[model samples]
Each structure stands twice: as structure tokens, then as C-alpha cells.
Target chain A: MGLYFVAKRFGVFLVIVWLAATLNFFLPRLSGDDPVANKLMEQASLGGYAQAGIAEMVKVYNQHFGLDKPLLTQYLNYVGNVAHGDLNYSIANYPRTVVDMIAEALPWTVGLLGMTTLVSFALGTFLGALLAWPGAPRWLQWFMPPLWALHAIPFFLLGLVLMWLLAFQFQILPIFGGHSPGAKVGLTVGFVLDVLRHAVLPSLSIVLVSVGGWALAMRGMMVTTMGEDYVTFAEAKGLRSLTIFMRYCMRNAILPQTTALALALGQILSGAVLVEVIFGYPGIGALLFQAIQENDFFVIQGVVFTVIVGLGFATFLLDILYPWLDPRITYRRS
Target chain B: MSETILRVERLRVAYDHPRGVVRAVDDVSFSLRPHERFGLAGESGSGKSTMALAILRMIKRPGRIEGGEVWLGDTALSGLDTDRMRALRLAGIAMVPQGSMNSLNPVVRIRDQIGDALADHGVGLKGRALAERVRDLLAQVGLPPDVARKYPHELSGGMKQRACIAIAICLRPKVIIADEPTSALDVVVQKQVMQTLGRVQQDLGAAIILVGHDMGLMAQFVDRLGIMYAGRLVEVAPIRDIITAPRHPYTRMLIESLPSLEQRGGLRGIPGLAPLLRELPPGCAFHPRCPAATERCRSEKPAVRAMGEDATVACHLA
Candidate 1:
């Protein structure tokens, strides 16, 4: 059953990727206005070429990019190239491959945004669990109103608020960028610490906006799960509060959050686009912003497809892990 | 005289809802003897289930045991703190819950469900000992050993009830409250499950409180019977005495409602709906629906008085 589930998910995933890439190839074409002509017109005078020379340049550009081929061949070649890790070259950042751009941006996003997403999930779920616990302290109840208010703040507005308080007003934390321009980039503890210090404000902005959402979701799930008969049975069993909370209540409640966790992890690729743009964080989110402004199709396609693949992969993993966590969920069910 | 293993003195449980306060279980008092099979027979909404939860303090907020003293042996259950009550729960008194189909955790294995009660209540046994205990409990409940490897959803209704029974008896508490334990099962399965429960109680030598609306099943399974109406206990007597000759009007109506195999007629349902506890008439709570109600019955309540050494009834007529 497990193997069947894996194979089924893998097959569906391949089909989705093929559809996305095909759409990527056709969508640009369907927009009309020859891209090569546009690229050449922007860089050089089109009137300088003879009529045959212009056709020759256009054909050569299309042929070099494999765009002159039949749609099927182009799709196959796109799939093959993607399989080989080639995401084409960025038009805006001339000569830099999209793969290269992604590689450069990934570490920054993972370090700051990925870590913050995980921190939000972990810290939020813990606090939420505590708040939902029947025996939880009354003092902890005071945190809910503030948490809900925090959660209601939009991502970019929060970025603005954090910058205003910590950067503009107090002038304590750095307002923008991943690191000081003068700081060395290396394995040394000093350099690493400097990078972390600069990441604090950007990461904090993302965390503050999202943490409350996870906490609220988790608390809601806990409330409903607490109503299940298993919870009452657990209480009736005379189990310790910790034991009951962790084994019985949490085992049931955490299933939904695990799914949320997977989707959130996939979202880490472009983490908080506006916040990254505002802070100049040099993450994929900022790259995508720059790509859109320049109409850098190659970069946009690469980033968007990567996110799609990431989301699909995360969902596949969740599908596999679900039955393990919830024994009631079996692969055989229709 | 038989030793009382569990006792309730003036127990009252009330729920505060938006509509009004409902006195779900009002001033109920009863006692259970060792090796006794006691049945609390009541119609739907008669507070039998609420009283069961009241016995264990399992009622959540919006509901509270307003006035109560429940003693599992000597310990006053209502007075114990949360942690102390938890420790005393499965060890001193356990429960075989109603809706057996849902009582066992669906995701949990039968082994874990049964073994957890043992381990959590300081049984401190694991591996072979735990497995052996699980197998023994399963066997006692007439379940196959392989059931331990399966989940609740994998089991049948009867099997789930059996598993719940095994869980209840795992700690061998002084009293096991089987609240409508067989209500959700078919007649044949209910009989089998009841037999399994009866055997488990006998083997463990523990008392049981069987609460349900099925008067016929109570007459067959329990030694003593208590009848509840509008949150109050109207009759408490030996099962044979109550079944053969009941004193309280509600008790008589309940016995009459049971379809007798020998009698060729449709079932006799009591006339009139039970009064909402929130808006019960002044005086006797049962007076609104009582045929024997008089001017005195409408103006005054009746105290439960001993009819003899073996019976007690609450009625001005009695």
C-alpha cells in the first residue's frame, strides 16, 4: 500500500510538472510580439540589418533557444533540459543562468525565511498547545488577544512597522540587506554571526506576522480535538496531564498542523515577497520582484516552476507520512 | 449486610446553558456493594448519563457538579484535586462508556488502549508482561489475540465494545460504571457484550453501575435496579422486586413499556413528554407526568424512604 501510494503520487507529480512547463513554454509564445525582435530592438538598431539579415538573426535566436522547433519537440527538450538542471539564462541579469541565480539566492532565503517559518510553526504550536490545555495557567490566557491582533497584521505592513520601531525610530537593528556591505563572507564564526545579526530584523518581520496564524490554527484544532471521545477516555484513564496532552490529544490535533507545516515549508522558497523587497534581503522573493519589473521571463518561469515543484514534493511527502501518524488513515480507503 | 464499594450522597449536577440552567442530575443518592450489578434505568434525558459523568467529575465547563459527595470506597471523589482525582480515576473507579463504537480511540491499537490504562495507573509493566496482560484482557472480553494488532475502525461494533470493556477492567477498580454499555449494539451483540461484561465483573470481583433505558436488559443482567425520572431517583430495589412489582409511577410505566415476549401487543409508551428540568413544575419534578399525582403531589416533593430491608421508593402514594 505504501509503495502504491508513492508510485501514484510520483506519476501525478510528473504529469503536473509537464503541464506547468508546457504552459510556461506556450504562455510566453501566446503573448505574441517576437521576444528576440524585442530583445534585439532594445539593444541595437533594427534598421541597420538587411531584410534577409533580420530574418536570419530572428531564426538564429529562435534556433539557439530551441524555440523554432515544433511545440512537442520544444516541450520534450524543455523537460530534458529541466531534468539535466538547466533553467535557461536570465535576460535581466545578462549571462547569469537562472539556476545560478537561484543557487545564489537559496541559502539566504533558507537561512532567514526557512528558519523563521520553522520557528513560527514550532514556537506557535507549543504556545498554542499550552493555551489549549485544560490545566494550562490562567496567566497564559492573556496572550490570546495580543496573538490574534498580531496575526491580523499584513506581511508588508508588519515589515514597515518593525523597521519603523527597531530601525527608523530606535536605530538599534539594521534596517535592510542580509549583511553589512563590508562584512566578509566565509566560514569564520565572526562572519557567520554578522550575517545572523543582519538577518534578525528581516526574519523577525516574517516571524511576527506568521507566528500568530500558526498558533491560532493549532489552538482551534486543539479545541476540536479536545472534544473527541479519545480525549475523555484519556482523562478517564487517569493518565498524567503531560502524558494525556502529548500522546492522546496532540497525536490527534497535530495531524492538520503537519499538513500546514509541509505547505509552509514549500512556501519558504519565495518567503514574504514584499518583506524581502522592502529589506533588500537578496532572497528569491526579491529576485522575483526584480525579474517581474524587468519582464525577465526566464527568471520568473524558473522561480515559479521551482515553487510549484516544491509544493508538489512537500504534498507528496505529507501523503506518505499521514498514515504513519494517523493509523485511521489507510492507503486502501476509497 | 454487603459492604458498599461505592456510594453517592445528595449528588447534584447542573449545566449552565444560554437558555437556562438544567439540573441534569438532581439530589441522586445510591450505593453499590462488592460483586453487585446495579442498573440505573431511566428514559432519555433522565440524567442517567449525566450522573455517570458526575460520578467521575468528567463533566466539562458549562456543567458542574453543583452539590455532590461520591465515595469510591472511602475517598470522597468530589473533593479530590485534579491530579489526585486523575490518579484515583482508573485505579479506584473506572468506566465502560456508552457509544462503545466511538469510546475506543480509532487511531489507537487495542493493545495500547488496554495497556495504557495499566501503565498510566502505575502498573509499570512492559514488553512481555504488558503484551501478556493485553492478551489476557482481550481473552477475558472474548476477543482474539490478533485484535491487539488492529485499530478500532478495523473492529466490529461488538469488538469495539469488548475492547472498551477490556480497557475498563484493566485496572480492576473498585467500581466500573458501564453507562449504557450495550445501547449501541444489536440485540444479539448486546447480549454477548453484556455477558462478556458480566464475566469480567465476576472474574475481577468488582462492582458495576449499569445505566441505560433498556429495562428488560437491566432486569436480566443487574442484581439491584435504580429508576431515575427528571434527574431524581424514584425507585431503588432488587431487580426482581422492581420488575415484578414497582411502587413509583415512573418505575411502573418504565416496566410496562418494555415489550414482553409473552404479551402480544404493541409497546406501551408513557403518555406526555418529560418536563424540561429548567422549567419543571413547582413541587415534585415528576408530578407533571405522573398519573398518581394529586393536589398534595403538586404542592410537595417526596423523600426516598425505605420500604423494607431490600427496597426504597420516593412517592407520597408509596
Candidate 2:
């Protein structure tokens, strides 16, 4: 039954990825503007070429971008290129392939956003479990109002306030880029610390806004699972309080968080867009925003495709992990 | 008489509601002897299950043992701290919780959970020894050895109940509380589960307090039974006497409600609902439904009195 579920979900995953890639191929072209003409107009604005030179430039640009081919042939070639793991060039950036731009920005997003999300999930779940523990400290209840308020605020708005207060007013954190402006980039401890220093503000904004959600979700799950008869049974069996809380209640409580973890991980891979933009951090969200503004259709498509694939992969992994985490869940062949 | 394995004297458990205090087990008392099966037979909300939970100190918030002295062999259960209570729980008195299907943790395997019960109480079994004990417990409860590897959901309702019985008797506690253990199961499964529970209890020489509303099931399993009504013990007698010659009006009513082949005139349910705990009727608490209730019965509370050898009743008429 497990193997069948794996195979079935894999088939569905492939189909979703194919649909996303196909949409990437045609949706940009359907905007009713020719890429070659757009490029010509761009150059004309710069006043570099005369009419005859501009015409030649357009012809060369069309061929260079593989836009000179018939639409059907281009479509087939697009599919064939994607099939072989080839991502063609960015029309707006000229000379840089869409894949290379994504590849360059991917690490920054994954590192900062990935680290913050993991930290928040871990910390929030632990705190939430403690808060919901029967007869937990009364003072801990004071944390609820602020956490609820934080969770309700949008990430971008929170990021703006954090930047203004922590970076501008207090001057406790770096305000721009992923590293010190003049620092040499390498494996050196100074460079790594500078990078981490720059990251603190951006990651903190995301963590502050998102941890509340994890805590609230986990606290709710813990409260419900704690009431289950098994928990009482555990207590009745002379198991210690910590044992009942951790093994009986938290074990079941963590199941829902694992599912949320997969989706949250997928989301962070797309980058903490507003946080990145606010801190002037070099990440995929900033790159994607620039591509959208310039009508770099291929770059936009590439970024979106990456997001879609990440989400699908995360979901598939969760589908497999869920049953293993919860014995009450089982797939039926029927 | 054999040694009293467990004793409860004037146990008063109540829930503090916003409106008023709901006396769930209001000044109720009972005792169980070694290897004796004592059943508390009552309708829903009669405080039978609450009384059972009170003995183990398992009642959640909103409910508490207001005034009670519970004794398990020699230990004073009511005064023990949480740590001592934890030590006394499975090692002194185990519980087969209601709806055995969900009594075991769903994420854990059957063997591991049984091992947890063993390990928590300082049973100290580990490795091959632990596995052997788990296998032995399973076999004692009539479950196959391979069931140790499977999850609770993999087993049938009867199987889960049987597994529950095994866990309850694993430490051989002097007294075991099987609260509605077979209620969720079907007839055939209930019979099988109860048989396994009965056989194991007998073999281990454990006293059991079987709490349920089903008088027929209680009669079949227990030799002595207590009939409860509105948080009060109405009658206590041998199961045969309670069935053949009940003293309390409520006991006769309960027997009348049961569908019997011998008394087959279409089951007659008693009139009126069980009292809401927060607003129990004055005096007898059953005067409104009792055929023989008088002004005296309505004005004064009746105390439990000896009727005959091994028979007790709390009704003034008796």
C-alpha cells in the first residue's frame, strides 16, 4: 500500500510540473508584445543605432533568442530544452541565462530564509508545548497577546518596522546587502560573521512574524492531544508527568507540525521577499521582483517554475512522511 | 473475609461548575476484597465512572475529590503526593480505560506501550527479557505474539480490549479498575474481551471494580455489585440477591429496564431522567419516581443500613 501511494503521488507530481512548465512557455508570449521589437525599442531609446543598424540588430536578436522560428517549432523546442534540463536565456538581461541568475540567488534565499524558518519552528513548538502543559506557569500566559498581535501583522509591514527600529534607530544591525560592503568574500571567519550580521535583521523579521503562527498552531494541537484517553492512560500507568507530556501528547501533536513544516520549507525557498527587499539582501525574491519590473518573462517563468516544483516536491515528501509519523494513518489499495 | 485490597470511605467527589458545585460522587463509599469483582451498576451520569476515576486520582480539572479517603491495601491513596501517586498507579492499581480501542497511544506499537507501562513502574525488564514479558502478556490475554509488532488500529475492538486487559494486569496490581472496558465493543467481541479480562484477573488474584450501566454484564461477571443513583449508593448486595431480591426501588427499576428472556413483557424503562448533578432532588433524590416515597422519605436523607448477611440498602422503606 505504501509503495502504491508513492508511485501514484509521483505520477501526479510529474503531471503538475509539466503543466507548470508548459504554462511558463506560452503565458509570456501571449502578452502580445514581440521580444525582438521590445529589445529594438530599448536600444533605440539609448540612441546607439540608426534605422538600418536597428533592423540588423533586431534580426540578430531574434535569431539569438531562438524567436526567429515558427511558433509550433519554438514550442516543441521549448519542451525539448526543458526535458534535457536546459533553461534558456533571459531576454531582458541579454547574455545571462535564466538558470544562472536563479542559481546565483538561490543560495542566499535558502540559507537565510531556511535557517530562520527552522529556528522559529523549533523554538515556537517547544515554547508552545510548554505553555500548553497542564499546570504550566501562570506568567507564561502573558506571552499570548503579543504573539497573537505579531502573527496577525503582514511580514512586509513587520519587516519595515524592524528595519526602521533595529537598523536605523538603534543601529544594532546591518542595513544593506548580505555582507559588509568592503569585506572580501571567502571562507574566512570575518567574512562569515559579517554575512551572519547582515542576515540577523532580515531573518529576525521573518522569524518574529512567523513564530507566533507555529506556537499558536502547536499549542492548539497539544491542548487537544493532551485530552486524549491515551495521555490519561499514560499518566495512570505511573509514567512521569514529563513522559506523559512528551511521549503521549507531544508525539501526536508534532504530526500536524511536520506537515506544516514541509509547506513552510517550500514557501521559504521562494525567499522572504519583503524582508530581502527591505534589507537590500541579495536573494531570489529580490531577483524575481527586478525581473518582473523589467518584463524579463523568462526569468519570471524560471523563478515561478522553481517555486512550483519546490512546493510539489515538499508536498510529496510530506505525503510519505505523514504515515510513518502516525501509525493511525495507512493507505488502502482500494 | 479475605483482606480488603481497596477501600473508599465516604468519598465525596464533585465538579465545581459556575452555577453550583455538582456532587458527582456525593459522600459515596464502597470496598473491594482480594480477588473480588465489584461492579458499580448505574445509568449514565450516576457517578459510577467518576467514582472509579476518583480512586486513581485521575479526574481532570473541574472535577476533584472534595472529601474522600481512599486506601489501597495499606497506603493512603488520597494523601500521596504526585510522585508517590505515579509510583502507586500501575504498580499498585491499574486501569482499563473506556473505549479500549483508543486507550493505547496510536503512534506507538502495542509491545512498546506495554513496555512503557512496565518500565515506568520500575519493572526493570529490558532487551530480550522485555520482549519475552510482552509476548507473555499477549499470550495471557489470548492475543497472538505477532500482535506485539502491530499498532492499535491494526487490531479489532476485541483485540484492543484484550490488549488493554493485559496491560492492566501486567504489573499484577492488587486492584484493577476496568471502566466501561467492553462498552464500545459488539456483543460477541464484548463477551470475548470480558472473558479474557475475567480469566486474567482471576489468575493474577486482582480485585476489579467493573463500572458500567449494563446490569446484565455486571450480573454475569461480578459476585457483589453496588447499584448507584444520583451520586449515591442505593444498594449493595451479592449479584444474585440484587437480581433475585433487590431491596432498593432503583435496583428493581434497573432490573426492569433490562431486556430479559424470563421477564419478557417488552422492556419497561423507568420514568423520569437521571438528576442533573448540579441540581439533585432533595432527600431520597428518587422520591419523585419512587412508588413508595412518603413525606418522611422526602424530608430526611437515608443512610446505608444492613439488610441481611452481605446485603445493604440506603432506602428508608427497606
Candidate 3:
């Protein structure tokens, strides 16, 4: 059973990656203008390529970018280039390859965003469980709504507000960028401390912004699971409240969240794209933003494809892990 | 003389709903002696189930025991906090709930679930002794010892009920409450399950409270019977008296409605639905349906009046 699940999920992963890449190839260019036209318009306004006529400019740009070739040829070559880790040069950053630029920014974003998402989800679930506990303090009822209200506010607004209060006004934390201006990057303890210090505000902003949603979801799930007859039976069996909450209620409650967690894993990658940009963290979201502005098609495609692949892989892992957690699930073809 | 194991005095369980304060169990009281089989017989919405839940302090949101003192031995169940109530459950007063066959965890093997009950109660026995005890419990319920290794879904319905019974009685508490324990089984299987329960009680000397709607089954299995209607016990009597000489008009109708095998006749269902608690008729809740209801019965509620050592009837005429 385990082997079959793993194999099926792997197959799904491949299909999802292929579909994402195919969609990426066309969706960006479908906005009723050719890439060369946008490029010509920009360059013409700058007077760098005004001497060239529209037709001639299109031809020259196409030849330069290998778009002069047939569509099939360009697609096949692009696929080959991707496989060989030879993503083309950025149109905006004429000297930098798409692969190199994304590689430079990927780890920073992943480290900051990934760690924060996990921490916030755990904290929210714990707090929600506590709040849902019978005879919880009256103060918590007053406290939870504001957190939920904060969750409804967009990430960018929250990020800007935090930046204004904590960074701009109070001068309590640094305003922008991933690291301090002169901080050295090395295997030294001082370097690690500087990196963490820089990370603290951005991580906190993202965590506070997202934690309430998880808390609400988990608490709702706990309430529903608590109503299940088995839970009532467990309580009546004279099990300790702590044991009943953890063992029976949590086991059942956490089942539905497994699917949510699977979807969240995919979301966690791109869900904070705006926040990463706002904080000036060197993550993929910021890289993608920069690449899009530069009309670096290769880099944009690479980043999107990579995100899709990561999401696919996470979903694959979810499919395999769920049955282990919930023994009641049986895989059958309909 | 049998020792009194439970005493519910002037018990009333009500729900504070938006419609009104609805009393689901109105001024009900009963006492069960040690080693007695006391059956509570009533149809759905009769409040017998509510009374059972109230006794365990398991009545959830909206429903509250407004006025009552449920004494299990000497501990007042309504007054006990959640922690004490939990400790009292299973170890002090075990229950076999309705649809209990579906209550066993579908994924867990039967033995592990039983072992969990034992372990949670801190029984602390292990190795051959634990295994022997589990096997003995399984055998006592008429299931083969090997069946304990299987999941609930793998077992037949009757076997699942048996497994539930085994789990209920595993700790050997003084009182066992079986709510519709045999309702889901075929007649042959029902008899077998009831007989198994009888053997267990005989061996352990535990007081039993069997709650079901089937008067015939209760009559066959229980020593005393309590008849409930619209959230109140309208009558309480020994099995012989309740079956032979029922006093309440509703009780007489219910007993008369039963189809006797020896008497060749079609069974007659009671004429009207039981009165809703929200819009109970003025005076006696059953007057609207009772064929023998008088003008006074329609105007004033009846109190349960003493009749004999074994019986009490709630009716204006009585």
C-alpha cells in the first residue's frame, strides 16, 4: 500500500510540473502583445532603439533572443536550455543569467519565510486549542477577535505599518534589506547573530499576519471534533481532560488539517510574496518581482516552474504520509 | 436485603432554549439496589436517554440539570466537577451506549481498545495475566479469544455489540448502564447478548440499568421497569406488576399495544405522537393522547403517588 501511494504521488508530481511549465510558457504572453513590442516600446521611449523601425526592431530583437526561429523550435530549445541549467540572460539585467540571479536570492527568502510559517502555524494551533478548552478565561474571548481582525488585513498593509512604527518611527529595528550594510557573511557566530537580528522583524511580521487564520481553522476543527460521539465517549470513560484533548480530540481534529497542511505547504512558498518584497528580504518572491519588471522571461519562468515543482513535491509527500497518520483511509480507484 | 446503589431525588433536567425553559426530565426519581436489573423503557424523545446522560454529567450545551441530586453510592453526580465525574465513569459506573457497535474505533484492534481502557484506569496488570483477562472477557461475551486481534469492521454486528459489552464491563464497576444495547441485533443475537450480560452480572453481582423501548425485552431481562413519557417517568413498578396490572392509562395502552405471540392478532401502534416538550399540553402531558383522560386530567398535572413496595403511578385518577 505504501509503495503504491508513493508511486502514484510521484506520477502526479511529474504531471503537475509539466502542466505548470506549459501554462507558464503561454499565460504570460497572452496579454494581447508580443514581448518584442513591449521591449520596443520601452526602448523607444528611452531613444536607445528609435533609429530602428517597428518591423526592423521586432526582427532584430527576435534574432537576438532566438525568437526569430519557429515557435516549436524556440519551445524545444527553451526546454533543452532549462534541462541543461542554461536559463537565458535577463533582459533587464543584460549580464546576469536567470538561473544565477534566482539562485542568489532563493535561499534567503526560503529560510525566512519557511521558518516563520511553521512557527506561526504551530503557535496558532496551540493557542486555539487552549481558547477552545471549556471554561477558558474571559480575557481570551476579548483577546482572540482582534487577532482575527488583524488576520483579515492584507500582509502588505501590516508590513508597512510595522515598518513605520518599529523601524521608521521608533528606530527599534532596521528599516529594509536582509542584512546590515557592513555585516560579513561567513561561518562565524557574529555573522549568524547579525543574520538572525535582521530576520527578526520580517519573520515576526509574517507570523503575526498569518497566525490567526490557522488558529481559527484549528479551533473550529477542535470544536467539531469535540462533538463527535467518540470524544464524548472518551470523556465519559474518565480519561483525564488533558489526555482526552491530546489523544482523542487532537487525533481526529488533526485529520482534516492534513489536507489543509498539504495545500498550505504549496501556499507557504508564494503566500508571502508581497511581504517578502515589503521587507526587502532576498527571497524568490522579491526575485520574481524584480525579474518581472525587467522582462526577464527566462528568470520568471524558472522561478514559477520551481515554485510549482516544490508544491507538487510537497503534495506528493502529503499523499504518502496521510495514510500513516490516519489508518482509516483506504485507497481505491473509483 | 439489597443495598441501595443509586438514588435520584426530585431530579429535573431542563434546557434553556430560545423557545423556553423546557424540562426534558420533570421531577423524576428512582433508586437501584445492588445486583438489581432496572430497566427504563420508553420510545425516542421519552427522556430516558436524557436521564442516563444526566446521571453521567454528560449533558452538553443548552441542557442542564436544573433541579436534581443524582447520588451514585454517596457521591452527588450533579455536584461533582468534570474531573471527579470522569473518574466516577467506567470505574464506578460504566455504560454501554446506544449504537455502541459503531462506537469502537474502526482502525484499532479490539484487544488494544480494551487494553486502553484497562491501562487508562491504571489497572497495571501485564504479560500473561493481562492476556488471560482479555481472553476471559472475550469468552464471557461469547466471542472467541482470537477475535480480539481483528478490527471492529471485520466483526459481525452482534460480535461488535459483544465487544462493546466487554469493554463496558471490563473494569467491573458496581453499576452498568446499557442503553439500547440489543436494539441493533437480530432477535436470536439479542437474546444471546442479553444472556451474556445476565451471566456477567450474575458472576460479578453488579447492578444493571438496561434502557430500551421494547417492553417485552425489558420484561424478559429486567427485574423492575420504569415507564417514561415526554421526559418524565409516568410509572415505576416491578416487572410482574407492570406487565400484569399497569395502573397509568398510558402504561395500560402501551402494554395493550404489544403483540403477544400466543394471541393471534395484528399489533396496534399508539394513536398519536408523544407531546413535544416545547408545546406540552396543559395539565397532564399525556391527556391529549390518553383515551381515559378526564377533565381534571386535562387541567392539572399529576404527581407520582405511592402504590405499593414495587410500584408508583403518575396520574390524577391514580
Candidate 4:
């Protein structure tokens, strides 16, 4: 990869993020329902109050949120604010900024989903490689059907089942939430251990469901790679079985798998929505879910924009790392 | 050193398919003297490459070494365990694989590719020593020392083939099998690579079994030649004898098929296609294609018998 290539890829990344942010800004507004007005109306009806002065309240709220301005002006202001890392404030949770909410939830999402995705990728890739390898144990073939079954089921559904079996029936683990209800949030070992304990069921469900996909993809790649002339030549060179398996077979096969992993990691924020909701883990997915239910446009926009940037960043890193992974991949303009 | 460095005794290789077992290499026997160049020439699907792979005990799945033993020096390759066989490979008997374009790992540097072969076989060279050895190997193959730092894709087709040859000779194996090693190269580069191969074989005092369909190349490079038809070696003789007074009818046709400056005429190819291994003709596999096929040649299989001190032919007419 060259400097020019890096610059070109970075330029593309910026354009993509900007396009995504613009789409995010316009999509919800196109729904034609004023989330602020809707929230106020729902609140008034729940409290059994008259709907009088609702128009006045809506106008006041719109002005305060800078929504009273022309569309272009509002778009410009939104882009500027986003550039400065200010996501304004949540519509439903008025006093709380979207940035604040995201900051609190981002770590949990990254910790849980990030860890699970990597573990599943590594474990699944190895298993998949072994599955296709002729020398692998015969018993490994037995893992195929069960893995496919687990992969077919949605992670949230798997989470529910695991929760029902382990948490509800046997009570072997915490049923929901990120930690014990009364535990203090800190860097203490006890607190960390408690968080990990709560993370177990959600991570298990995710790892189980996703591992099969990685394995299947890896196995396909491995099979094709195994047929490559280089692998045969490597064997003819009399390399150790382990060396051949790792360097020649798995090394080449893992290139496409790494690309998938980067994409998967980028999608982790949005993908964790259902899993986090089920586990009651305070991650961005759960935050986005709560924001959607309450019609908090700022939080939704903030979360979505963050995911777009993350995905673009992931691909950008992939571009930078690609030349290293496979020497044939040159980023030269030609 | 023994008179014969590598001896392949009654080697048989079969592929198990849904329809039937395809005998790719059937009871083929040959041997190589030290510092000798033995060429195995045959048309496509004639089990020449299979015999070469079987010699290395590298017949892949669905294909098994059904019978016979490959003896490199005094050691029987079949009796040894996989680790032992692997150890013997590149150390005792290395192979310059066919399809050199994709033989070297595309991502790996030439130096590492060579170094790994050395390292795996317990060469124990590291850092500067390994680097120097790799450069030396590259130089010996007529490649620039800088090629050691380049990846396979960075090198040209001929360069890649030379790199493969470099790797094959890295361990100074007793026998090197060049299986159509220059099949993918043009005539010019093919000649250069073969010369490089010949030079390396001489330097190492190792015998070479050159497997290819090019009779011209075999005649030029090899001391002796074996003609394979279907799944059998129909003629095994000195190159000069095989080319000048070919014994088997198939060998005669193969020699005649080669274009010559001396006789300018229409090209002549063998009359029929090589028989399918699964359903070979009842007699000699070459009988259908043989120009001098007789009633006995069509009905009875001819065992390989010595016709003279220097040659053997599996033809009843001979």
C-alpha cells in the first residue's frame, strides 16, 4: 500500500460516512410524524390531561431543538454539531445528551460483542479448517450438524433458550442486566468478575450462533486452498504437517475470513440490539432500542452515525492491512 | 553410494471412483542410477505424473498406492511412518512440482520458502546463515540474489520455476523428480530451466526422473527414457536407443510424432486416444493405439521383458 492509496481510501471513507450521516438525518424526518409532538401527546393522554396548548408546546420544543429553521440550515447545523462530536440532546430524555448516553453504553457493547466476535472467529476458523482437512480426526465431523442447527437459530432466540434453561430453570446464572442489581460500578475485581459472570449467557448465545458461519466460510475457503498447487508443493518440500497446516493451508484460507471478521466487528453495534435487549446489557444496541421506543431522534442519529463511522474505519483498516496479508494485493492506482 | 540411488518396484496407484477403481499407475517398475537423468514420457492421462507422485508417496485422496514399494537407497518409503516419509522428502528425495506458476506460495517470499524447507528438515540455519543459503540457492538456479526477497507473483513464470528448482535442490536430495517442471514455460525458458535442472542434478550428484510429454526435451536432457501408455511403462531404454531404434510401437509413434528439420511433412499423431484407466483394452493398454497391433497383441497382455542389455519393452511383437 502507498501513501496515495491510503489517502484515496481515507477520502472514500469520509465520503461514505458523510453520505450515511445525511441519510440518517433525513430518513426519520421522512416518516412525517413529529417525534417531539408524539411524545408530548402520549404523555398528556397517559396523564388524562386535555390536549390544549399542545401546538404551543410543540413550537417551543422545535425552536429549542433548532428544528424551526429551514431544512438546509438544520442539516448544516446537524453536520457541524456532529463534526464537533456533539450529538445535542435526546428528545425523550431531554436533559441527557446523546453523547453522554452513548459514552455510558459503548463500552459494554464493545466488550461483549467485540470479545464474542473474535472468539467465535478464531474458534470457528480453526474448526472449519480442521473440518475440511483430510487428516483431522473423524469425530470432528460429528460437530457439523449441531453447529448448523445452532447457526440456523437466531442468537436472541438462543439467548432466550439459554436464559430459560440455565437462569430460569436451574438458576445457574444471572437472568438479566449487566451485573448484580446492587453491585457498585468500579474497577474492583469483584465488579469486573460480576460483569463477566453476567456476560456469560449473552456471549455464549452469540458465540454459539455465529461460530458456525465462520466455520462454514472458513471450511469452504480451506477446501479450495487445500487444492491449490502451492499446498501440494509445500508437502513435496517435506514441511511438517503442523507447519503445512498453519502456514500453507490456514494462512491463505484466513484472508477472506479476516475481511468478514472486520465487517462483523463493524456491525457489532447494531447486531447486538436484540441480544442486549434480551440480556438487559447496557450496550449501544439496548440504548438504540430504548431510544427507538421513546422516539429519541438524537440518540438514534448518534448511535447510527457512530456505527457508520466504525464500519468505514474497519474497512479502511482492512485496506491498510490487506497488502500485508496477501502480497499480491497492491493499492497502487494502476 | 549405491549403483542405483532410487528404485521403484512394481508401483501401483488406483483411484476409487463411484463407477469403478481407476488404476492410474499399474505395476510400473523402474530404477535410477546415481547422477543419471531418467525421462518418463507419455501423452496426457498416461499415468506418468501419477507414477512420479506415487514415487514420493503423495497420491492424494480417492487415489491410493494400492501395491508396490518405493525404495530410496535401502529404505522402503512405504514401510516408513508419515513423519519419516515427510522427513525423507526434500532431504532424501525432493520434487520440482508441475505447474510452477502456482507452485511457490504466492504470499511468501522466495527466501522464506527456501529457508522453511531447510529449517523443517533440520538444517538449523538462522538469520544471516539462512539468508545466505537462500541467496546461494537462488544464484545456483540462475536467479539474482535479490529474487530471494521477492514474492512468487513478483517473479516471472521462468523465475518462479527456477525458484521451485532452487527449493528442490536446497536439501541436496538423492533423487529429484521434475514432473513436467517446465510444462508451463515457453520453449526458450523451458530450455533454460532444464539446463538449470541438469546443472543442479550434476552438482548434487543426484539422479533426476524428468516426467513430461516432450520427447524432444527428453531426448536432449535425459540419459534414459521410459514411455508410458495408459497405466503401464511400455518401453524403458537408453535415450539414444529409444530415439534411434524405438522398441515399442507406441514409442515409435511418439518419436515419429516429433517434428524434424531433416524430414519436412505433415505431422503424425498416434492413431487413437489413450485408453481410460477404468476400462482398459483386454491386452496391452497400447494395443488399440499401436500401429503394429497383432492378434496376440489384442488378446494377451505382454509382460515387460528385456529385449537387449540396455532396454525392456512390453510388446509381443518386439
Which clashing pairs does model 4 show? none
Judging by TM-score, tell me the better candidate of 1 and 3.
1
What TM-score fits each model?
0.94, 0.96, 0.88, 0.97
How do the residues B1-318 of candidate 4 rate in per-residue lDDT, one tens digit apiece? 237888888999999999999999988888889899999998899899889889889998889999999888899988999999999999999999884448988888889998889889988798999888988898899999999899988988999999999999998899999999998789899889989999999999999999998888888999999998888988999999988999888888888888999999999887878788889899887877777788998889999997776578898988
Better DockQ candidate (1, 2): 2
- The DockQ leader among the candidates is 4
lDDT of each: 0.84, 0.86, 0.81, 0.91
Candidate 4: global Cα-lDDT?
Answer: 0.91
What are the candidates' individual DockQ scores?
Answer: 0.65, 0.78, 0.45, 0.84
What docking grade applies to model 3? acceptable
Better of 2 and 3 by TM-score: 2
Candidates sorted by TM-score, best first = 4, 2, 1, 3
**Structure candidate 2, residue pairs in collision:** none
Give the 10-residue window scoring lowest on summed lDDT in candidate 1 chain A.
Answer: A43-52
lDDT score of residue A263 within candidate 3: 77
CA lDDT, candidate 4, residue A219 = 96
lDDT of 2: 0.86
Better by lDDT, candidate 3 or 1: 1
Error of 1 at A10 (Å): 1.1
Regions more than 4 Å wrong, model 2: A1-4, A48-52
